[model samples]
Target: MYTFIISIILLVAGYFTYGKYIEKMFGVKEERATPAYVNQDGVDYLPMSSNKNSLIQLLNIAGVGPIFGPIMGALYGPVAFIWIVLGCIFAGAVHDYLTGMISIRNRGAHLPELAGKFLGKVMKHVVNAFAILLLILVGTVFVTSPASLLHNLMNGKVSLLIITLFIFGYYILATLLPIDKIIGRFYPIFGALLLVASLGVGGMLIIQQVPIPELTLANLHPDQMPIFPLLFLTITCGALSGFHATQTPIISRTTQTEKQGRKIFYGMMIAEGIIAMVWAAAAMSLFQGANGLNELLATGGTGLVVSEVAKVTLGAVVGTLAVLGVIVLPITSGDTAFRSARMIIADYIKLPQFSMKKRLLIAVPLFVISIALTQIDFNILWRYFSWANQATAAIALFVGAMYLFIARKNYWVALIPGAFILYTTTVYILNAEIGFRQSLNVSYVAGAVISVVLVILFFKAAQKSRAAELSLEVDISDYRNIAS
Candidate 1:
């Protein structure tokens, strides 16, 4: 009981401290100019629709990651929550908010294009490549995780091929359908199903008088005492995630008011954090440390932890419903992934004569590749994906630093986040023990060194820009005085 209370307190406090701070900083001001690009598209660029509530956005953005990451974090005991909450505040929310706002201000341009404007054409392509690689890694992991869960629920009766086809077909439908119509109509139905499934499992656990084990700091697993994976997963949005960069912009493009961006983005992310906490609690309550680890390994992914919890909490019937709900969330994520990837490709490669066709062409192959990769081990894939995802986010921090230097004449705010992410990610890379992990670590080390170099270059560029502006102002003032 005390643990649950503490978790809730931490979540609420973090939300108020970091989430609301960002909100207050970017809050609506009557005199502030409406971003020009946002004004141009009244149809798509309007503030969030009145019909759209915060819950739908929450469900849309929260995927299997939130469920699984926390379970993995729980392997390290209660200490994991500290990193999750703090990381979300300083790293995750800031990235989501700034990237979303920038995209909105730049006429729904995604992260890569914004990077180009701030970082230059060469760095722009570098960032875009990084972003795309992150997306592919994220998309592939998401695809495999849920498919594995679905396969288990079907008692392994469903062939991987059929699962891939079903997922691919769903993406195609989501893509062909208009964005507003799909999100507005289908998402609410899916969200409600998820709520019912989660609650149903909870209700059954209560009715069945299932035993809740007494948790203690001493009882925590000693072998898995490492904090870095918890740090890695915590920032990944079961606790917090860089993937929110893609999600925030999608929500931003549809938001009805500039103010609502904070509400939607932060609100949804917090809700996800809460969901992750609940799953972590559920895992602890349902299984012992070794059992939980074995279950995750036996089922072939972390998502199985949620399904297994539901099966134990409820009977098979309701458990099946829980599995289906789990599947839907990732499907929504995949839909978003496909759309975002298409948007990225469209922005970078002009196929003016064949725009829609070009986007579909890019999306289909990417989806196919992702589905093929789904056959691999999900745990290993997730670890790689999380690291790659953070690396891209590190680059985004550099871009944000440049923005701050240009607009505020102070780069400390963005620089601090960038530096922290770089350090944490480097620690993660160095500690990782995969095959060729050392080589990968060296690459990231090199990347971090380059990021620091770029930070210096950006400051120089900002100084030149400021100098030119000052010169123009002085010449104009002198001419006016002479004429007078």
Candidate 2:
């Protein structure tokens, strides 16, 4: 219990302290006009108040990952607390703030464009495909999860196919309409429900004095899954998720000022960390122990655990509301995933998005692909998504580090976390069924080798980027002097 409370406090404090340092390092320009104002197209690039932007940003990134992932992470015992706090503070929030602010500085470019600019031209195409694939997977998973949950809630009275089609239709409307029309308007209401759900469950657990397990380094899993890479991958959203990078640009284009980046990006991630911490604590305290949690998980999975916990803690009336809140997380994220895909494709093709016809040109095919993906098994899609998600995160962090390096700021803030997650991403695929399927020792050694090589290559690119940036600055200064 003390560990859990301390972890939450640390996360909040980290935002005020470390988060402030990050803001300072990035050098926020309050006077600088944002993309929303400069490029007011009444579509994606329209300014919104900080409060609205923060709410949208929170819901946009707060997929079921925070709830489901932490519930699963509870099987590993209180050690999950450590990852949620540290990973969120250092890697997750930093990745988000940098990505959002950098996008604003670059006319609201998406991750692929930013990746290409910072990482390399080749990475632009690679990361483009990588990000679009991740978004589609996210969209498809979110749609299926919510539709299934809603079907179960209705006791299978409603056809799953109908619920799914209904959701896909909503996604189309949300993606096709202006940002403020569907997403910007509905997200605040959804954000309120999300808060009520998490806070209600977390508050009750504390009020009831549920005995949350204290932190320990011991391997507490019933299956004794190694905590090294698996735990990191298992808990991404509340800790650090590359998916947030894609979502941040959505708000980045809508932000009225650079100052809000800290709140909308960094602060909301802390909010998610709090949400994650609460769920992890609740899952740990409610179940008999790690063994009990594992048994239930193996039998019924995350949805069952969520339903049981909500009903037990919050009662049937409010628990139902909480479940609705959980449903909201995925639906909100899914729409934006399709929306981001549309924007990314439009940007890639250099198509003007002032008209609906141009937007549909990209959005139509994305929805078609997402619809096709629904036929694939959810678990299989998740397995591939898990690695790709973290890989996307690693790349985003490297991009952040590169941006800071070129700007002559403290690049280590992003570089260290980027390196750690890169190692995790590397080791997981090498050992997982999806990738090379190597032995643990082979994975460890090979992952290290691969990470080292990549870091060296990153530095090479950074050096070239930094030199070019410096030359540009000098040229600007010289041109200014001549004009004067």
**C-alpha local distance difference test of each model:** 0.63, 0.90
> Model 2: runs farther than 4 Å from truth?
217-223, 470-484
Superposed on all Cα atoms, the candidates' RMSDs to the truth, in angstroms, are: 6.7, 3.5
lDDT of 2 by residue, 127-223 (tens): 9999999999999999999998898778899999999999999999999999999999999999999999999998898888889998765544435
lDDT (10s digit) by residue, model 1, range 93-169? 66766676666556566778777777667877986777777676667766766777788777889897688678777
lDDT of 1: 0.63
- Error (Å) of candidate 1 at residue 212 is 7.7
Please give the lDDT score for candidate 2: 0.90
TM-score of 1: 0.82
Give the clashing residue pairs of candidate 2, or none. none
Quote the RMSD, in angstroms, for model 2: 3.5
Give the runs in model 1 whose Cα sits over 4 Å from its true position.
27-56, 196-224, 233-235, 290-292, 351-356, 409-414, 431-484
